[model samples]
Target chain A: MEVLFTFLPKTAHQEKLEKEFPDVDFHFTYKEKSRLPSVDILVTYGEDITEEDISKAEKLKWIMVASAGVEKMPLQAMKERGIAVSNVKGIHKTPMAESVLAHLLALKRSLPFIYESQQNNQWNRKTGSSELFGSTALILGPGAIGSEIGRLLQAFGVRTIGCNRSGSAADYMDEMTSFEDILMKLPEADLIISVVPSTKETKHMLKKEHFEAMKKDAIFMNFGRGDLVEDQILLEALENGAVGYAVLDVFEQEPLPPEHPYWSMKNVVISPHASSHSKKYVDRALDIFIPNLHKWLSEDLNPTNLVNLEKGY
Target chain B: MEVLFTFLPKTAHQEKLEKEFPDVDFHFTYKEKSRLPSVDILVTYGEDITEEDISKAEKLKWIMVASAGVEKMPLQAMKERGIAVSNVKGIHKTPMAESVLAHLLALKRSLPFIYESQQNNQWNRKTGSSELFGSTALILGPGAIGSEIGRLLQAFGVRTIGCNRSGSAADYMDEMTSFEDILMKLPEADLIISVVPSTKETKHMLKKEHFEAMKKDAIFMNFGRGDLVEDQILLEALENGAVGYAVLDVFEQEPLPPEHPYWSMKNVVISPHASSHSKKYVDRALDIFIPNLHKWLSEDLNPTNLVNLEKGY
Candidate 1:
């Protein structure tokens, strides 16, 4: 099998793959698009693959995505070409969940203000703080990352509610509701975290109306796709004091423009799309790919994380 | 029964106490030390009672301190007078533990740096982050707060080691050691939190030698007493880059002087002794005090958190 890794694998990672699967031609180079010509397997991390590369790869049988979301990839073309797609799903649960808790805790503890006080050489004991215990949290996705966040929050005695498309039973939800029923839950959540994927059904899921429903002191965090939340509406809500604090790790635009008010908002934490970027990232990505590689070699090509191209997630 | 509330109880808190205990005369005043003259039951939060006040209180039988630490109070005088003392112990567990986690996670994830970048309108994704999963933490004073912090970090898969004076078993600690054996464990800790009391033996416990033994990139936090850690020694370590980050919630000299070098250190987070100040402070303190009130009235007069004068904690 001829494989091309679009993600620049670390030397150890590349060596491990090469050593484990000696029969496979593992061509791991991020810059060389020419290697895509005769590749049978391509691994990427939601990178936008060129149509030219897709057309040239007549021998391509599978595409492995090294991310939970596969929305940015050419899903339609890949589907038309009969390419089996498997993504590194559910692997971001630990890092993403940790990031959410970290940011939320920082806001409640007045940590940013405390740091500012430190900078000013002021001993500020007046800044009031609240604990995670007895707080209500609403998780918009409730999939791998959301459920894991809920579980972690539960350890702190936070009551967790989850919203899902089908209102199905979710692992760590104290209560589950349909997406349509989520707006009412907005007023109930002390914390509102949206980890919903980017799709037609979820596009602009959280706007002014949804933000308005949340408690004035509610902390909102978006570690999901930027398309799921309207930035302008969120900004207005923040300005109007309808939302207390917003930790935006994902934005409508990458490397959010300098003109954006979010950068200047004292109540907002602009995390530069690195919430899931951990030192152990390469190892986590491999946990998904290596296991599936074994299954693929045995002709059981349908991996556990096989993506449904029509769903666009 | 006569009572003097020196902590300035909120009207609501005063009303609740008065409503619950009709027989007790609640002398609620933060100022006017004249109120202490006829007090039989004194309610305070580690405020020192002068020799004059002690001599004036002819009927003073019990002092209810609304904090875990009673070091500032006249312990020797109270002991000599055969006056009973009670403190609200273990009430700070939740808030203190949460504060420790908040600061540690912020350092590991570069939340402070990210907030700085947001202020500068810079999109910097290169500020690397380390995950808590594979890290190890060493907690000093493995009492209620220490154990609670250990349990919470366990959910994040952090290996927790605890140090206690007696080398006694503590909950949620993967390993427990004595104060003497702590030096060896210093180099292994990614995070070191000190919650040890400000006792004679514990004063300057974490000095230059301890800081030198710690991992170069280790994050150190002092949420215990200021006296337990030597400020000058810590400043030297921070300057020398021996300590990666220092979250000092307590200082030897509070309102830590404007000219203090800690104010100028980028690697330090001057926490201003507010780590345990939560909005729910009144309610949590009452959790310990109210029950003791009932016990005192029944003539049993035995409080769960009665302080041993010699220990000074």
Candidate 2:
């Protein structure tokens, strides 16, 4: 069985993958390259691959995406070709969840102001700082990353509520609600974390109306996708005090424009899209892929983290 | 039956106490003033309570301190008078632990640079960021706050080691060791968190030699008293790359001088000792203290969180 490694910035991560899978016959190529007829498994990074890449690999049975979001991939083509798609879902959970908690704690503890004071060597003890314990956290996505965040928040004794497509119960979550029902529960959340994948149903999910439902001092954290939230509406929410602070790690544009107003906003924390980019990220991705590769080859078993091309999970 | 509030800034907290303990006779006064003869319990805030105040309170059997640190109080004087002392220990755990995690995540994920770029409205993608999972964390104090931090770290799958006087086993802590043994283990820690109380033995515990033992790119966090670490030694470590970065919330002196090098160091994240100063802190402290007070009065039970006068815990 042949395995094809198709990813962008392939040269950067190729050495690491070569070292881990010395025994496997791996073909390292750009996502745009013509696929060989014998290719059975394809691994991709980013959105460099096209529909033609999927159609050419006649024997391709599996396509693994090295990212949490699979929205940009040619999902319909893969599904029609009987190619199973799996994603690097839970791998981003720790770093993403850590980022969410970092902003939440920073906002409540006022670390930015404290850091500024330290910059000026001032020992001003500003009042009105708050703790996370006994506060409510509303997680918009109850997937691997969102659930992991809830578990972390549980240790701090915060009430956790989750909003998902189905509105089903999640471990460590106090309550679950559907996407349409999020407005009803918005006032209960002191902090709202958006980790939902980008899709038709979720695109622009956090619009002006959702912000209107939030509490006065509510903090909004987005580590999922930039397109999932309407930035203009979010800014309006911040301006009106409907949103206390917005901690963003992803934006619609890769290099946010210099003239953007978010740069000067004190209430917003704009982080480059690097929340899930960690040192061990590649190793972690390999940790999952290698085992699944062996399982697919030997037992013809489907991977556990298979992503539905139609549903866009 | 009678309670005396003996703190200079007791008026604000005293009002809440009065409402909670309406049945008990409450007398509010500064520590320099004579305590009411009928007082059985004395509550104080600051370090320096006059000797005259202690001698005058002949009926005082129990003393409660509002702060976490009991170092400034005359422990020997209270011990000689057979007075029981209890403090609001672990009340600072939520905010402090959250702060430590905030800085650790920020340093690992490079939040400072991201925030700066956000200020410039530049959305740059940075590589080489590290994750907390599979990392090793060494907590100096394995008391309530430290153990609470341990629970938070467990969800991230980090290896947690602790150093305390007793070296007792704690949940979520992989191993416990004495302060003297910390040097030998420092090399293994990716993150070193100082949560130890400021005491004679612990003062300046993280000196030049200790910093030299840490691994390269290792992160240092000080949510404990600033006196526990030697400032000059820490600066040298940061400069020499022995300690990659530091997230300090407390300092030896309040309002660190503007000329201090810490303010300008890119490797350091200086916070003005506001980690535990959250808005809900008072309510949380009261929640713990009120229940303990009820136990003390109704059940004829001594508070479980009693402090050891000699140990200064």
Candidate 3:
């Protein structure tokens, strides 16, 4: 089998794949090349792939996305080309969930303020420190990542309210609410976390009305796509005290633009979309991919986390 | 039936006490007045009491310390006077445990660096983000607070090792080790949390040898007592890269001197002895005190969390 990887794997991973799968012809490159026409399988982070590349790749049968967010991929082109796509979905559950808790706890414990105070040798004790225990959290899109976050939050005695499109019950959630009914549950949530995927229905899901329904001191975090809510609306909500604080990991624009108002906002925490960036990221993704490769070589081809290109999950 | 409170209670708490215990005479004061001799019971935060106060309180039979630490209170004088003492020991479990997690997550997530980058309009993706998952944590003094911390860490898949006077098993801990065996376990801990009480046995518990035994990147947190390790030794550990980071919530000196090097060190996170400070602190402490008060009022006199005067727990 001829395979192409657009992203570089770690040296150990490279060694493992080359050593273990000696029958497969592997090519790794970032430069534009003619290898696309002959590639049978392509692995990527879903960011660099384009519709042009998809059109030229006549031999490509499968696209293995190493990252969870496959929104950037040319889903329509791949669908037309009959390319089967799979992502490392559950691999992010640990790192992403840990990131969510990190932001939540840091904001609640006033670590930013404490860090600032330390620079000035200030011993101010009035940090407005609060407990995660007994607080209510509304988690949008309670999939693997959200469920993991809910489980961790519950360990601290937090009430987890899971919100999804189907209003289906999920693990570790105290209650379930559909996306349409999120506003009704908004007022009760001390924290509102967005982990919903990027899709037609989910785009601009959180409008001004949703922010208005939230408590004045409610902490809002967006670990999902940034287009879930308009930046201006979130800014207005924060400025007017409709929402107390925001921990933003993803943004509508990459690098967030130097002149963005969020950079200057005291209540805003910008993470440069690095929530899922871990040393073990590539290793975990390959763990899922390597097993699927074995299944494909055996002619089963029943890969886990096969993405429905139309639904865009 | 006369009761004296050294600290002021919330209006709701005062109203509840006044309305419920109508026959009991309650006096709230911070002034050094002559109400000590007539008091049958005293309520304090264990900080303001002294040997002179104990000797002056001829009619005082019991001391209700509204805090976990009784190290500040004249335990010797109270024992000599045959005065009974009780403290709200378990009330700190929730907030303190949450604080420990807050510091851990904040450091692991590089919030301090993120905040700095935000201030400079730098969109840096290399945050060195790490997960609590698969990490090992050694918790010193796995009592109520440590057990609570262990439970929360366990949810994140962290291996929790509990250390106390006895090597007895504790809730939420994967394994149990005595303090004597801490050096052996130190190398395996990614995080070492101190929640031990301030006592002769625990004084200077983490010394130069202990720091040398830890992993190069091990994170040390002191939530137990400031005097558990000297400032000089900890500073040396951080300077020499023997320890990666230190989150100090307690210090040997209050309002840690302006000239202290810890304030300027990037690897050090300083919290002004405020980890236990919570909005619900008094309410939770009173929850334990009020139920115990019923026993005292009914001539039972026995209280929950009665301190062993000699051990100073």
Candidate 4:
């Protein structure tokens, strides 16, 4: 069997894989296009997978993404090829939540203002600093990542209201509500965080009506798919003071076009979609890969966390 | 009863107090010096309390300082006059802990670098990012504030070692050790946070030797007393790569001076001695004040969190 791994290979990991499947020809390079026809498995973190590679790979039975989202993959081609797919989802639960908190605390504590003061060699105590202690947070898409975020916030004494498709209670949330009721529940939260994924139904789910329904001083944060929010509506909300602050980790476009208004906005906090980027990412990714690899080898057990292509999740 | 308050009066709180103690004369201004002579009780957050004022308040039986530190107060006079002195010590636990987490997450996720990129209107994804998960944190002074910080860090899957005088295990710490063992244990930590107070033994507790003992890539944060750390030694560590990053909220000299190298250092993050700051400070202050007021009115038990003039804690 020929296995093609797209990420940089670690010595220990390569040795471990070789020891497990002694007869397998393991190739760890993205540029090995000539070997595509004989490749039995394709492992990727979304840099080199393309429709052409998928078409050329006649023996490819499995394609694994080492990140949560498989949106970067040529899903249509893989789906038609009857290729099994799985993504590393649960690993990013804590790191992304931690990243959300990093910005939320900075915004509340005015750490950026403090940084500006430090640049001028001044020691200034920024007044009117807020606390998460008594504030209420509305968490959209209360799945793994969102629930983890709520759990962390719960430690800070913030009341978390989980919003999902079903109005079912989650472990860390103080209460639960349906996503359909988001606008009605909007004004109640002092902090709003959305972790909704990108889908046909979820794209552009939160916009002008929802932002306008929020409290004037409410903080809006999106660590979810950028498509879940409308960029123009968010910009208008910030300018109109409907949203007190917006901490955006993902954008409708990557690199944010260099001249976007969000880059220079006073009330905006921007990060280059690196929230889930952790040194431990590869190790955690391996945890998913090893398990699913065994399942694929057995050929009888269905792979866990396999992406449902028709549902487009 | 005559009560002299040195803080500006909030109308709602004043009304609530007056409604309960109708016969008591409450003078809520520092400039009301004529009433100082007859002040039976003094409430201050440290602007109006002076040795001369203490001498004039012959009838002052109780003096409540609405802050954590009593180093600025005339302890000798208060102890000599047989007046009860209390300072709000435990209220800053959550806010300071929050502040510590803010910087800890920021450092681990490269928030300072993100801010610089944002300043240039750039969207560069910083690689080789770190996480608090599976990291070891050594917390100095595991009392009210330090323990709270440990609890929050524990939620992020960090192994926290608590340091105290007795070396007894604290609630949130995975292990406990004495302050004497800090040097030996220093090399084990990826993160070191100090919440130790300004005391005779604690003054200049951390210096060049301690920073040199730490892991080369370790992050050093101080939300403790400025005197506990030697700033010159800290600067040397940062300059020589002995310390990977230094987030200092307090300094030996603050408004941290215009000429200090820390203000210009690339590896430094500074906040102006405002770790304990929060918009709910007054409400938390009232939590201490109201309790002490009732205790005084009852005239039975001594006020809680009293400052020991002799031991100076």
Model 4 / residue A127 / CA error / Å: 3.7
lDDT of 4 by residue, A136-188 (tens): 99999888999999999999899999998888888799999997888888999
What tens digits encode model 2's per-residue C-alpha lDDT throughout B197-293?
Answer: 8899889877788898998879888888889987888889999999888888788876777788888888887777777787666666667778878
For each candidate in turn, the TM-score is 0.97, 0.88, 0.98, 0.96
Candidate 4 achieves a global lDDT of 0.85
All candidates: DockQ: 0.79, 0.60, 0.80, 0.73
* Model 3, runs deviating above 4 Å: A31-33, B31-33
- Pick the winner on DockQ between candidates 1 and 4: 1
On residues A241-293, what C-alpha lDDT tens digit does candidate 1 reach at each position?
99898889999998799899887877888999888878888898888888888
- Model 4 residue runs over 4 Å out of place are A10-16, B31-34
Off by over 4 Å in 1: none
| Tens-digit lDDT track of model 4 for B65-134 | 8888787778888899999888889989878888889888887777888888998987788645688888
lDDT of 2: 0.79
Worst 10 residues of 2 chain A by lDDT: A7-16
Candidate 4 chain B weakest lDDT stretch, 10 residues: B27-36
Q: Pick the winner on DockQ between candidates 3 and 4.
A: 3
Best by TM-score: 3
* Cα lDDT, model 2, residue A130: 76
